[model samples]
Target: MGERAQQIPFYCDGSYLCEPCAELCRTKVQRQKPVKTKAYKFNYQCQCKFMRGGCKLRYQGEEGVVLSEEERSKQKEDYKKYLNEKLLMMAAREVPLNRLNQQQFEFSLESNLENAMLYDDEITRAVALSCIPPEIVDLASNPVQQLKELVNWFKFEFFSWCDKPPCPSCKSDQAVERVGSDTPNAEDREYHASQVEKYLCKNCKTTVRFPRYNHPMKLFETRTGRCGEWANAFTCLCIALGHDARKVLDWTDHVWTEVYLAQWERWVHIDACEPLFDKPLTYEKGWGKELTYCIAFSSKEMVDVSKRYVVDPVLNRMRRDRVNEKWLADTLQQRREALWSMQGDSQAQFLRKRYQIEQGHLDAGSAHKFPSEPFQPRQSGAQ
Candidate 1:
């Protein structure tokens, strides 16, 4: 069984398992040398048939080859060696990945927004028509108007939000069930997918592939995914349309975009899924969602912009245990140096100063609490 499968304590299908039946399901596999793959599902009927739905807990089979003791030891040794090498590389600052929290920064930092510009004209026309009258047709002159139009088009007409994908074979949304997840294969990686969700169709027993494509241009073809896809593609489009944009990643398992409006000289929050614009506090005050780290990634720089979104710094700090704050700060500074090294002195200086100002705000925000008067629910479905 995979690491994640073994850790699950219960499954929710409105089914109950008696104590004895649950104990049997838990220990049966460990006590015997199993012939089947170690994966378990909570949907099976117990042999006892003691309960109404017969206990939705059963082992798939006892039918697979087992690993020997020697092989297990070899695997453990190899993993330890790999970890040692990874630690050395991280210590050298060769990679910006957080040691304790790998998800603190994106592994693939190269911008794919340039690919999105390939269809700039098509997107421009769509955005122009999306705006309200007196309709702003020439987006080149008015960047802010252009951004608003683009957001409108992308959110309402361009992409879709998928909760559970419809089963292709049975053509039923409810027929498909999530079995497990797997690493993206070579073909799926072409779309820049980090993971692929596996679903089983009850009617035809067909395994469906739901690759969460991260490359925005590739997403133009799929047009359907969760918040990750929506934010990715939208951020790409924002850059493609000549707006200075960044992909804002929330460690709390959400993402959105931040576009730098030169007119305002600051970044503005935008959520393509909710179709919301410039509402940084919406996640905290409106949805009552507690936030931790909110990092913004652009082609030039990676920034820590958590202060702008967090409701109460002291309270939210409790959830910010992924990495020591000082270590994270130092790592970010090192990464900024590396990323900005290629630019001219003037440009590099400008970015460095801007980053300093942003960090100052983060430092100041740490000392206070925010008002809770504007409490509201999430605009869309659950993130």
Candidate 2:
């Protein structure tokens, strides 16, 4: 039977075979694989390969009601609004501890550093250095001077500020103004944006959606936003430049960065938007912005660094009513302990010692002290 298998009339059109041959054919037919069918999505509707000729099998399921584009959009908007309300209600009741956990986890991975280095190519750095002063280059060994050069290079040469998105048609910033805000679209959400700001171009009457992308890689291309984008991009660059950097988020509508200068053995403020280095009290003392909470997020830890900025801790304490003071303190301590435990013994000891030193400075009300430098204007021309 093995040698004769090739001679068997398996594909005979209508030929009749004897009983044994017929049984073999039947067995072969029974063992044969079924033909495979494919399915795909087209115009938000499922199409089955078997019923390719005007298939209506999709109507048999919950997708029976084919919604109009307008109806679908309305449904999406309603759902987003409902979710936002729920989130606000939840935030009112409790501290958003998950924000710290999720954000710090992203930082802890140091994914931003690699992405930043990849995005900020050597070509770009070379171009930036060409414009930097020779004095700054000579003082490259000094961490303070190194940071100043980096900030100046980043702000003046690398990135631009966007108070309002420029008109795509006319390419004019003067005519583009914010009209409204909405939830981020699928593409925007893919890049990790919380909101999409809609701007109207007066020249062309065109509406543009500006998604505030948190990802540093995306910001490298856009290179124009408020403090959030500047801080996000610059913090990553600081890490790439071999400085211990962390993103600082001010709850009272501002953002910046903190870099731990080993020579100084303390974290100093560096706002790329301001292009300012070691200016911790600029917001409170210079800009007169009421500071409540400033949280610094790094790869190893999430710290409540509000004391570093707030000129009056007594008054700032009154503004920090989002969570019970004891609860917030306990939560921060637990997070620090959890993060520190993940490190090697030496690293954990270093972090604990640093934390103690920072706390001592905060206690002594000397955390805001910054070296005197000539008053420098905001290089970004940000209002």
- Report each candidate's C-alpha RMSD, comma-separated, in the order given: 16.3, 24.5
- The number of the candidate with the highest TM-score is 1
**lDDT of the structure predicted as candidate 2:** 0.64
Q: Record all residue pairs in model 1 with backbone atoms less than 3 Å apart, i.e. clashing.
A: 35-62, 35-63, 35-64, 36-63, 36-64
Per-residue lDDT over 218-291 for candidate 1, one digit per residue giving the tens place of the 0 to 100 score: 67777888888888778766765567778887877788998877777666778888777776788876775668
Tell me the tens digit of each residue's lDDT in model 2 across 268-307: 8888887677777777766656677787776577778998
> Model 1, stretches more than 4 Å misplaced?
1-137, 361-376
> What TM-score, to 2 decimals, does candidate 1 have?
0.64
Q: For candidate 2, give the lDDT of residue 31.
A: 32
Show where candidate 2 strays beyond 4 Å: 1-140, 369-383
Query: Candidate 2 — worst ten consecutive residues by lDDT sum?
Result: 40-49
**lDDT, candidate 1, at 259:** 86
